[model samples]
Target: MRDILVFLIVFGSIPYILRNPVVGALMWVWISVMSPHTQGWGFATTFPFAYIIAVCTLASLVFTRQPRNLPTAAPVLALLAFTVWMNVTFPFSLYPEYAFPQYTRVMKIMLMTFVVAMVIKSKEDVRRLVWVLVISLGFYGVKGGIFTLRSGGGQRVWGPGATFIGDNNALALALIMVIPLMYYLQQTSTNKWVRRGLTASILLSALAALGSYSRGGLLAIVAMCGFMWLKSRKKLMVGSVLAAVGPALLLFMPQEWASRMDTIDNYQADASAMGRINAWYMAWNLARDRIFGGGFEIYEPATFAAYAPVPNDVHAAHSIYFQVLGEHGFGGLALYLLVGITTWRTAAWIVKNAPKAPGMQWAVEMATMMQTSLMGFAVGGSFLSLTYFDVPYYLMCALVATRVLVQANLPPPAPTMTRPG
Candidate 1:
């Protein structure tokens, strides 16, 4: 019965998992553990669905055939272990209550990273995962579209747990990240039905993003689309036309959606931009003073003290790069870059080498989406602290792991047989 329940949950959650790894992972995190912000209760309060899904996945993995290990797992594991060690040893001062949440977040990411490496062994698995993600995201987009039409499209409407749901910008960013992957899937899928489905999912997700009134999200999507277009001009033209027409016909949205175009302008004035420059200035001065860094998670009070005059509100540098530099110092920053660069380079290499291989294609798609997502995050991180979100970080690690796995599985280049004269 326990095994059956686990199977049911893993299969049931497949739809959501397909749509967005971030959402799926977050759901798992919420369920396996509890969060205080939502109801002051643990898993029972916020993540019932995720809890069930996670338990089932663990059970399924245990019961399934023994999984093969990848070669790159060692380095990735070492880095993660080092990161956790540094966090603990550095004695970064965060609220005691946050300790559990932080730990749980890390664990969830690790779990997802493992899943990405273990489960995505073949092209079929990749296709299944992509379809699931598309369908799930499409469902959300449809839901969001309905809500926008019903509410006359004002502020972004979140379902039950608004606490877990990110703001318009964040949601937009999340959806934007998926767009490239969807496009890649569409291009590679042989089955007409699969291609059609991916197309529909992309359109729906884009509409959902636009409806969210997240200027940042809109910008990110446009940027991703542009990048894809640059890669394939013919596809880009068709996509651009479809994108323009789809939102107009499907839902009644607000004109203010366009206002987000001016979002960059705020940075110019440096006043109403909400203290971004001040934060950057403060971060620089803090870095200068503490050449080694304040410690992981130590950005709040320790660094804030230097900023003076106003009360020191405990906040992160709003950028992952800066956050790493400020908290973990130069060494930590180097590791972060090493992990990122290694994963990225490996993914790119696989894509370039195995253009025709389905697994390779999927890897390319994942790599492209991740790279774009990272870019979006970097831009958005200039104003928001998105690193706390498990999606981007976990996906990056998972892709690296996947690259390692894929490379390890490839048969050694057949030894050129010497001509037997």
Candidate 2:
């Protein structure tokens, strides 16, 4: 039944997507990020819904009269450059067979990201996309939060299987990133009941993150909350609340969660932590030796044996920074970092400029919260290989689109007349 419903909804939307490719892009973001099909059983679980949506979207894009244009923002340009660089290094991949599949996956994500940038034309479109994200990922946030509460944080909250966020740690980081977006919606929404419900969702999602018991997630929450407070207009009030709530939530978690987090301070004693360090070292060594890096799937035993100090201590390049470094080499890592740095700057620009346009305060809030989300990703993803995650890229797309709208709506500067120069 669940599978049938998912199938019906997805297939039902194809016509609308063909009419307006933006719908396809939004649906693409939904299926790709949330992996709703993964929630169902039977045929829907194996169905290639995303591929169908992508084809329909591209067909619509080619046929539709709608004006298509990518944003000229620095972030978008950097993303394009990074995409090209990925292709450049593909032929040089150490294990092209393993790398090809992952490379294709990343390319698809990049393509959809650009589609989002081109199609999202208005503030309403941005809001709609935000709603899609919230509803899709927030399902996990709300459900996971409840599970955490009911289990007394004794069990971990996990994402749907076979998805990027399927792991507990990945799900926790994903939730942490989404929480701020929830806050953004709550702030912009006029409905009191909706705001109230969102507040509850926020609390539950935080609990869910705790339930995951990911030390990196815990650090990310701290970093994100701090950055969020810094961005708030009422910093003192926000700071006060955070100061009060932070410890209370931590105390509520079970002893096991505490012990796991405690390992952060004594990482040398933790085997998992040590393994990650070894992987990081391997990535660095590979990048130093090879110009284009080892290409995708470079975290194999052979690569680690060649580059890792402890040849026996092989592990995935758990860090996003290292993941790019090992797979793409120094140039790829530079482009990857450039994408993030430029996105951050672009969001900051929107925050600064959005206020100049009256009634654009929502844009300000959006950019600010997006920055908070980026902060969470940057911190949490440091310990996780989510370098190719669609969520962050989509966030960048929204930010880039938001900047475009904000700039367009911004009142033209009053004409200046100079007497004598």
Candidate 3:
């Protein structure tokens, strides 16, 4: 029954996707971000919904008169450069067989990311994309919040299976990032019920993040909250809410959760933490030795034996920074960082320059929330190997799209008289 429903929904959307490529893009984002089929039993669980949708979207984009102008924004260009760099390292991959599969997955994500930038022409289109994200990811957030409440925060909160956010830690970070977007929705929503629902979703998502029992996630939430408070216009209200809710959620968790989070400070005694450090060292060493790094899946025991200070300690490069450094090298890491920094600056530029006019407020809000989400990703991703995750890339696409709209709305600067100099 579940499989049938999912199949019908995905297949039924094709007609609409063909007429409007934006629908296909949103459906693709929903499938990729939510992995709704993963929640079902039978054929739907294994179906290649994203690929089918992507092919259709591309065909529609070509057949239709939709403009395919790729934005020349710094972030967009850096992302393209990064994608090209990823492919360049393919031949040099220490484990070609393993690297090939990872390469295919990441390339698909990057492909869709560019598709988003092209299809997103107006503020409404961007809002539709955000709606898909909130509905999809927030499904887990709302469910996890209820689960945490029911379980008394004893068990961990996990995301959809067979996806980037399958683990508790990954889901935690994803939720933390989405909370700010939820707030954006709440603030902009005129309907009282919609605002209330979003308000509840925001609180529930925070609870879901707390219930994940991830030490790195804990740090991430703390860092994100601090940044959100700093960026907010109504500091007193935001601060009051944080002050009231923060301690209550922490106290709601079980002692075991506290014990695990305590290891953040005493990481020397924690085997998992020590292993991550060992992997970081291995990545740094490999990046120094290889021009293009060791390529994908280079965190194998053999590579560790050759490069790791503690060669016997075979572990994944748990940090995003180290993961890219090991898999792609220093150059790849540079490009990756460049994409993030440029995207961030683009958001900042929008917030600073976008007029306070009624029609332009959405762009400002989107840019502000984009920064908040990036804050969560930056801090949470430091200890998580999510270098190839699609959410951050989508956030970059959002910022670029918003920047384009904001630029169009801004007035031209006045001409300066050369004689004055």
Compose the digit string of candidate 1's lDDT tens values, residues 1-421. 4334444555677665544443344445433222223333343343345555665555555555645343355436545754664465355433334444654655565665565555455445444555554444455565665666667766574422443234565556656666666777787779999788777767656666777766556556656656555545377676777578755743456656555556656656534344544555555555566555555445455446675223354554656666666655566667766666665565566656555444455566666665665556555554554544554544554565556556665667778889888
Clashes of each: 8, 0, 0
True-vs-predicted CA distance for residue 211, candidate 3, Å: 1.0
How far is each candidate from the true structure, as Cα RMSD in Å? 6.3, 1.2, 1.5
Better of 1 and 3 by TM-score: 3
Model 3 stretches astray by more than 4 angstroms: 356-358, 415-421
Error of 1 at 168 (Å): 2.1
- The C-alpha TM-scores of every prediction are 0.72, 0.98, 0.97
What would the TM-score be for candidate 1 when compared with the true structure? 0.72
Q: Per-residue lDDT of 165-247 in model 2, one digit per residue for the tens?
A: 99999999999999999999998899999999999999899988999889999999999998998889999988998888888
C-alpha displacement of 103 in model 1, angstroms?
3.7
lDDT (Cα atoms) of all candidates against the true structure:
0.55, 0.91, 0.90
Candidates ranked by lDDT: 2, 3, 1
Instruction: Name the best candidate (by lDDT).
Output: 2
lDDT of 2 at 163: 91
Q: Considering TM-score, which of the candidate structures 1 and 2 is the better prediction for this target?
A: 2
Q: Could you tell me which residue pairs clash in candidate 3? A: none
